[model samples]
Target chain A: MTPPRTPVLGRRSLLAAGAALPLLARPAIAQNSLKGTKLTILAGSWYVPENNTQLDQLAAEVSKDTGMEVRVERFAGDELGTKVASVIGTGRGADLGVGVEFDTYLYAPKLLDVTDLAEEIGKQYGGWFDVARAACMVDGRWKSLCIGQAPAAWNYRTDMFAAAGVDKFPDTFDELLVAAKKLHAKGTPIGMTLGHASGDARSTNYPVLWAFGGKEFEADGKTVAINSPETIAATEWYAECFKYMDPGVTAWLDPDNNQAFLAGKCSATINVNTIYLAARAAAPTDPVKKNIVENMNHGLWPKGPAGRYANYNINVWLPFAASPNPEGQKAFLRAWYSKNFLPNWTKTGQSYFIPTFAGFDAMDVWPDDPKLKIFRELNKLNRLAGYAGPPSPAAAEAVSKYVLVDMFAKACTGQMKPAEAVKWAERQYDQIAKKRRA
Target chain B: MSATTLPAAPARPRARRLASWLDNERTLGLLLVAPVVILLAALVAYPFFTAIRSALSDQTLADAGEFVGLDNFANLFQDDIYLRALRNTLVYTAASVVAKLVLGLALALLLNETFPFRRLVRAAVLLPWIVPTVLGTMAWLWMFNPNFSVLNWVLTNIFGLRGLPWLTDPALAMVSVITVNVWRGTPFLGITVLAALQSIPPDLYDASAIDGANKLQRFRYVTLPLVMPVLLTALVLSTIWTFSDFGVVYGLTQGGPMNATHVLATLAFRTGLTAGQIGEGAAISLTMLPLLLVLIVWQLRRIRRSAVA
Candidate 1:
C-alpha cells in the first residue's frame, strides 16, 4: 500500500497463497477419507495359531498404511464355508471371505469381480496354474483370488515302514496296498480317509480314483462318467486297500489323520503339511515331536492305474459384492502380494500353505526344510475334484456331496458293493447334472 | 312394563357407538392380536412357506429355481444316502432319547439323596449341560481318537479289554454318536426331572411308604405318575431336540463311517449348503415337518389328558 507495490512481492505472495490453499485443504480431505474406513475378512484357521498370527500381522501392516481399520475373524476350515454362506445368504458378512472347498465360483454373482487385480497378479507371477485357473475362473472372468495350495502328501512313519520291511514308499497303488497290509498286520494300519471330509476324503480318495482312471463327469460336463468300469475297478481296489486301513478310517476327517499320525496310531496318512507343521512346532523336548521328526517321512502319492494324480486343496479369497470398502480390499491384496508379507506368511504356515504363484517358489521357506521339497510337485501333478470338467456348479455340487469319496466309503464300509457304490455315485452325478441343465 | 322401563333411557349417540364397538368381540380380538399375528407371520410363517416353495423347485445357491414340481422330492426318494440318513436319524433319536431318559432318571435319583457337598454335586452334574455342546463334543472327539483316546487307554490298559473302535466301525460309529448325544443331553433331562422331583409333595411319598410300597413300587406308582406330566414334557422336548440335533453328530462323526450317523439335519446341511442343492435340502428339512407335526399332536394330546387327569 505504501511505496508503489513491488511487482515481485505481489507475484510471490499470489504463488505462495495458491500453493498453501491445497496444502491447507489436504488434511481435511484425508480426514474425510479416513473418517470411518473399515474392513472385515473372514479368514480360515487353516494352520491354527500361525495363520492367526500372520493375519494379525497383515492387518496391522494394512492399517498402518491405509488408515483403514481391519478386522480379521478366523473360523475353523470345517465351519468357515457354512458361516460364509449363511452370512452371504442374509446379505450380511465381512468384506471378504476365504474358503477351501466352498467353491466361491458357485456364488459368483455375489462376489466382487477381481478380474483386473487377478490379471495383474497373473501377469506378475507368470500365468496361474491350471488348478488355480479352474478354481477362480467363472464365466470367463476371475471371481476370486487363489491364495495357496494345501498340497496333499503321504505323511508316513519311516520307522513303521522299516519295521514292515518296506524299502520305500510304494511306487504303485498295488505296491502301496501290499505295504499297507503288511503294516496292518503289524497293528499299525495305515489311516486313510473314507468319510465326508472336505479335504481328506478328496485328497486321499480323488487320487486313487484318478489313478484308476475314474472321472466324475465326462468332458462334456453333462454325461456322468463315475459309474464306468474304470471306476468300478478303482472301487474294488480301494475296498481292498480299506482292509489295510484302520477300521475308523471311514469316520476320520482331515484332522483325524493328523492326530492319528502324531499319536503313533497310524503307519501313514494322506494329509496336508499340517501334520508336519504341528510336529515341527512342538517343543524340542516333546516326545511326539521327536518321534515325528525322527520317524515321519513324506512321499508322493503312489502311481494309480491311469497314472498318479493328487487332489489339490485349493483355497480362494473372495471379496463380497456387498462390501463397502473395495478400496481397502484392493489395498489389502496389494499388501498380501508384497514380498514383505507373503514369504513371512508362507514361512509361518510351515509349508502348509504352498504359494500358488510361481514367483514365490524361491522363497527360503520351501528350501529351508528338506521335507518341503516334496511340495514343489504339488502344482505339477495335481487335479481338483472335477478334473476332466471345469469346476462348474454341478461339479462343485458333486464334490460338496463327496460323491466320489462316498462311493469309495460305501464300498469300504460294506454299505454297498463296489459296483453298487459306483452306480450310486453315478446317480448323484446325474442329479447334479440335471439341476445344472435345468 | 315397556313404558315403565323409563322409555328405554334415551340413549346417547356416544353410548350407542361404544356399545356397538364393544359388542364386536371378533374385530376387537383381531385388533388386539394384530401385531403379534403379523410378527409371527413375518418371522415363522414366511421362511417356512418359502422353504416349502423352494423345495419344489430346482434352486441352487446361485439361481432362483424354477418350479420343477415334485422333481426334487422324487430325486430324494431315489437317493440312497437320503434313505440312510432318514434311518440314521430315527435310530440316533431313539437310542439317544432312551439312553438319556434311563441315565437322567438315575442321576436325578442319586442327586435327590442328602449328602455332604450335595449342592456342589448338583452343580457339577450341570457342567456337561452348561458347557457348550460343540466344545463338549470336541473333548469327546479327542477322547474317541484312535490313538490318543483316553477311553481306549482306559479300556485296553486298565480294564484289560481290547480297544474298541468307538467311531470307526459303522455299528460303533452309531454307538459313539449316540453315546455322545446321551452324554451332552442326559444332564438337561436330569436337571429338569430333579426339579420336578423336588416339587412332588413329600406327603405322597410318606403315604406310599405307609401303604407298604417298596422303593421300586413307590417309584413305579406314585413317583412316576406324579412326575409323568413333567417327564412327558421333558421327553417330548428332548425327542424334538435329539431328532434335530446337528452340532453333536456333525462335530463328532459328521454322519460318517459311510453315512451311518447322518440325521435329517446333517443331510439337509449336506444337501443345501454343501451340495448347493438348496431345493433338495429344503425338501429334506421339510420332511421333518410331517413327523414333527405328528409329534406335536401327540404331545398336545398327552398334555391335555394329563391336565384333565
Candidate 2:
C-alpha cells in the first residue's frame, strides 16, 4: 500500500504551481524547456519530414515556454483502425492518439468519451468541429476519435476537360456520367481505385451508392437497407462508371488513385485533395497543374437521386482514460489544438492534408486553388454520410467473404444479375450476421 | 538361504530408502518441467475459455443482447452462409495443399537443374514469399482487377477476348485465392522437397541406371519413397497454414465476389474481432481445434506405427 500524507508530483507541475503563487514567476520559467517532458502523438504519415522539422522547432519554442518535448509515430492510415482497435481491445493505447474514420466508429468499451473534452475544447476554439458529430455517436455517446480534413471528392484534369470540350463542373450524376464516358472514349480513364481492396472499393463506390439514393440502413437506421431497389440501380450505375475508372484502381491505395488522375491519365477522379501534392512531387514540371489552376474548377458534389452527398473520412486526437497521465494528456491536447499547431502542421506536410481546425478556412494553404473552395464548402457540411459505418471492418470481411465480394465478382463477370448479387449479400449477411460479428 | 542371510542386516530399510530415492528423482524431473507445462496451459487457456463461453451464448454483438445458450452455434448450423464458409474452407485446404505440393515440386525440379543465374532465379522465386502477404496479395488484386488488371489486359487484348473478373466469380474467387496461396506457398514446398531430394544418394541413381531402370521407374521407386516422409510433414504444415490464412484473402478480395472465398479461420476471426460476437467467433474457431487435433493424433499414430514396423 502506498501511504500518502501528500501526493508526490512532477518537478514541472510543482514548479508551475510554485510559480503560480507569484504572477511573474510563471512566465519566468519558460514552457519550452525540452528537459523532463515528452509528447507522443499517434498518427499516420501525417507528420512528414517538413512537419517534423517544424515540430522540432515548435518543440524548442514550447520547451522554452512550458518545458515540453514532442514526437510523432507514422502508421499507414488504412492500417490504423485495426492497429488501434487491437491496442484499445487489449486495454492499452497512446495518451493522445489520432483514429481513422472507421476506427473511430469501432471503439470498444475500453475508450473514454471525448464529448466533454470536445465541449471544453469547442468552448476554447469555437467550432473546430467541421461537421456534426452525429455519425460518430455510439449508443448515445459522442466520440472525438476522428478529425481528418475530409474525404477527397473533386478531382478533374482541366487539360482533359478542355480537350473534351467540357466547360464547367457537372451538377448531376447523369451529366458526370456522360462526361466520364466521353473522356474514356477519348482514351482517358476518368477515375482510379484499387477495386479488390475494401477500403478502395467502399470509398470509390459507397458515395455513388448513397448519392444515387441507395442506403445500407433503413430510414430509422434500425435494419440493413442495402437490398433496396435504389441500391441495385446504384450498383448497376457504378458498374457502368467502371469503364471510365483507371484500370490500376484494383491495386491503388490512397492518394495513388488520385495521383493517377492528376498525372493526366484521367479526366477526373473523386479522390482526396492531399494527393495533388504527390502528383506535384511525382512531376513538378508537369504542365497539368499550371493549366488546370487556370481552367479546372471545383464545386459541390454532382446531384443524384439522394441529392449530393460526399463521404468524409475524418481523423481525431482523443484522450484515453487508461492513459497513465490523463491530465497531462488533456493539457497536451489543449495546447495541441490551438491555431499555433494547425498552420505549422499543415504547412509541414507540404500542403498534404486540409486542416480540420476551425478558422483554418481562411488560411492561404490553397487560396484561389480550384478545388479548395469545393473542399472548404463541403468540409463545412461534412457528414459521416451513412446510417452504418463501413460494414464494421470486421463484419465487412465476413460479408465480403460470404457474399458481397464474390457476388460482385459474379455480377461483374456477367454470371449473375445485380439483384442476384444484392440478394446473395443479404442472405450471406444474415448467416454471417449470426456466426461472426465484429 | 542366501537371501535370508543377506537380508538379515536390513532388507526393508534398503527397499524403503531406494523407493524414496527413485520417488525424489521423479519429483525433481516434474519440478523442472512444471514451469513450461504451466506456461503452455496459461497460453492456451484464454482462447479456450473464450471459445467455450461464446459457443454457449447467443451472440448479440450488434444489438447487445442477453446471453443465449447454444443459439449462435444453432444459428451456425442453420445458416447456409456460414455453412458455405466451412465448405469453402475445406475446399480451399484440399486445393491449396495439392496445388502447392504439385507446383512446388515441379518448380523445385526445375531449379534443381544446373542453369545460369540459378542462385538469382532461386532468390527471385522466393521473393513473393518474402514480400509481405498483404502487399503481395494487393499486387495480385491489381493484376486481377477487371478494369486495370494486366492479367485481364493480356487475356483480352493480346488474346482478343474480354476482361475476366478473376477475383469476382464465385468459383474463380476460390481459384484466385488458391492460386495466390499456391504462388506464395510453392517456394516453401520447393525448399522442403529440394532438401528431401538432395538427401538421396547418387549411388542409388547409379545403381538404378545400371539396372536399366528408366527415368520414370527410377523416380517412382527411389524418389517417391524417399520424399514421402518429408512431403507428409510439408503437407501437414501447408495444410494448417492455408487453413488459418487470413491476410491474403482479407487483403486481396476481402473474401468477396460473395463470401465464396471465406475459410474457417478467417470466418472465426471476422466474427470475434469485427462483429464482437465474441462467443460465436470463439465457437467458429473452436470447431477447427477438434478436427486439427484428430489430424495431429492421426499423424502421431502413423509415425509411431511406422517406427514400430
Candidate 3:
C-alpha cells in the first residue's frame, strides 16, 4: 500500500548493476586517484633479460591503466640491496623495488605494510607458500610481496654420471661423496662454490649444514647454536667432499659454476635453472650446447644426515614507507599480481622464477619441462638463510658476511680443523647476536 | 676665476674601486681558490666528518644509530674477519708496492732508452693504466678462471704441468690479486718515473762515465740519486693507492677463498654497505686514517730533509 510494485526490468537492471559495480568502479577510482602521480620502481636486473622486458611492459600497462607515470630502474642483483638500503635510510628513492632474500625483515620498519594486498593476492592464488610468508611477513604483517624463488638444485650432466658408474645423481651426501670421487677419477668432478658468492655459496653450503642437523641459531632465533657436534660433522663431511671436487670451487663466484657446467668442465654443480635454460637457448647454434642440452638434467639437493633442504634466493617486491603515493604503489602491486601480468612474467622466467604461490606448483610451467620438475618441490624444502631462526637483520648480516660459507671453506682448505671452523662461526654468530642486542 | 680655480679631484666610480680591490694579489688569490675550497669542503670534509660521526655511533643502513664511542673499534679487533682483513691489507699493500716499484722503475728505464717507436711504446705502456680498473680486472678474472683459464691452459698444454689453482688456493688467490695490482699499478709508476727520468741532465751521466764509472756504476751513482726523489714520491703515492685498493681484489676474488685477500676497503664495504652496519663499516674505514697519517707525515719529513740537504 505504501510503495508501488517495482518493475521486473528495473529489479533485473539493479541486480546487473550491483554485480558490475567493482568491475566499473575500481579502474575509475584507481585512474582518478593516481592521475598525474608518478611511480618509480627499482629492480635488480634479471638473469633472463626477457624478465626485465616483461616487467617494463607491466609498468607501462599499469601506467596506461591508472593514468600514473611509471618508471622502472634496473641494477645489478648484487648492487640492488645496497641501493634499497640507501633508499630506506634516506626516506626517499623509488616508490617500489625488488628486495632479495629476507630484505623485507632487514628494512621492515621503513617498508610499507601491504597486509591487505598480500591477503587478496594469496586468496586469489590459493595462498602464498610458507617460505614466502617467512620471507615477507614481519610481526604478523605482510611487509612485502614475495615475487618468487630462484631454486638452486644440482644441475648435472647425465652422461658424466653414467660414465662415472652412477646411474643417477646422488640422493644423499654420503653417496654424493663416493660419486664425487668416481667423477673426479673420471675427470668430471662436482663443483659447489665455497667462495663469498651471495647466491651459489650460501645456496649450496646452507643445505649441507641443515642436512647434517646444524643450524645457525636455536629455534629462539637468538641463541648461537652453530658450535654443536652436528656442525663439526657437517664440516668434516664437507672437508672430505672437498677432496674430490674441482679445486676451483673455493674461488668460484656465483657465475663460475654455470660457466664450468656449460663448458663441460664439471659433471655436477648446485645452480639454478639458468644454466639449463642457457644451454637450451644456445643448442640450435652450437653443437656442444646441443650436446649439453641433451645430457644435462636437474637433481634435488642431496639429503644429509638430518634431512634434505635448500636455500633458494627469494625475491620480493617492497614498497617504501616514504613513497608519496602509497595508494598508487599498492595499485601497481595489485595489477602485478593479477592473472594477466604474473602468469606471463612467470612463464618468461622459464621456471627460474618459481612463483611463491602454492597454486603455481600445479601450473603447466613446471610439468611441461622435465628438467624443471625438480624445482616444483624445491620450495617445499626451502629454508630461509637463518634456519630455525627468524629472518632478522642479524641473519642477513651474517649472510652478507658469508659466515657459514667461510666456516665450511676454512675446514675444506685446511685453514682450520672442522671443530675450529665450527667454533669460529659460533664466535661470529655470537658477535652478530651481541651487536643486535645492543 | 681662471687663476683661483683648481681642478677638482676626480671621484672614483664604485665599479672601478671594486675592480682595483679584485686586482689585489691577496683578493685575487682567494677568489681563484674559493671554488676549490668550497668543493673540497662539500665533497671531502663534510663526508669525512660524517664518517667519523658514524664511526663513533651505532649507525646502520636503516637506523640513524646512537653514539657508542669506541665500542665499534674495540669490537673490530675481537672480530677475526676484521683482524684478518687488517693483516691482508698490510700484506697486500706491502707486496704490491714493492713489486710495482721494482717493475715500474725497470719499465721506466726501458722506456727511457732509444728504441723503435719509443713514443708508441710509452703510450702502449700506459694502456694498462688507461684501461679502467674494473674492465682490466675482469679480463684478469677470465685468465684466472678455474676451468677455462687461458693461463692454466697454457701452463698445462705448453709447459706439460698441472694447472695451478690461480684463484682458488688462499695463498694463490693472494698472489693472483697482488699480481693484478702490480700489473695495473706499475704503469702509473712507470709513466711518472719516466717523466722524472727524462728531466735528468744527460751531462750527469756523461760526467759520471768520464770519471771511470761503468754503466752499472753510472746508474748506481748518477741515475739513482737523480731519480731517487721522484722514486720516493712515486712510492708514496703508490703505497696510498695500493693500501686503499678495492677494485682489483673485489673484481678478481672479492676477498674470498676464506678472506685471504680482503683489504680494508673491501671489508669496510662488505661490513658497512652489504651487511648494513654503517657504524662498524665507518669504524673500519676510520682505522685507516691514523696509518695513512703516519705515512704522509713520514713522506713529508723525508721530502723536507732531502730538500734541506
**Model number with the top DockQ:** 3
State the lDDT of candidate 2 residue by residue for A322-361, as single tens digits.
Answer: 6665544544554444444544455444333555556555
Candidate 3: residue A339 Cα off by (Å): 1.1
TM-score of chain A of each: 0.89, 0.76, 0.93
lDDT of each: 0.79, 0.61, 0.86
**Which ranges in model 3 have alpha carbons more than 4 Å from their true place?**
A1-29, A364-367, B1-13, B16-29, B299-309
Q: What is the interface RMSD of each candidate, in Å?
A: 1.7, 5.5, 1.1
Q: Write one digit per residue (lDDT tens) for candidate 3, span B1-309.
A: 464444432344666888899989999999999999999999999999999999999988767889899999999999999999999999999999999999999999999999899999999989889999999999999999977899989988999998999988988899999999999999999989899989999988888878999988988888888888888888998998899999999998889988888889999998888888899999999998987888899999998998899
Residue-level lDDT tens digits of model 3 in A1-438: 011111122223322432443322354335688899999999988877767777777677667767899999888856788788789878888899898766787778888889988887898778998889999999999999999998888999999999999998889988999999999999999998998887898888999999999999888888888998999999999999999988789999989999999989999999988898888878888899999989999999888889899888888999999999898888778767766557667776767889888787666555366677677777788899787888887888899889999999999989899999999999999999998887
User: What is the lDDT for A343 in model 3?
Assistant: 66
Regions of candidate 1 where Cα sits further than 4 Å from its true position: A1-35, A48-51, A362-365, B1-39, B113-116, B206-217, B301-309
User: Can you give the TM-score per candidate against the true fold?
Assistant: 0.87, 0.78, 0.93
How do all the candidates rank in terms of DockQ, highest first? 3, 1, 2
Better of 1 and 3 by DockQ: 3
Give me the displacement of residue A82 in model 1, in angstroms.
Answer: 1.7
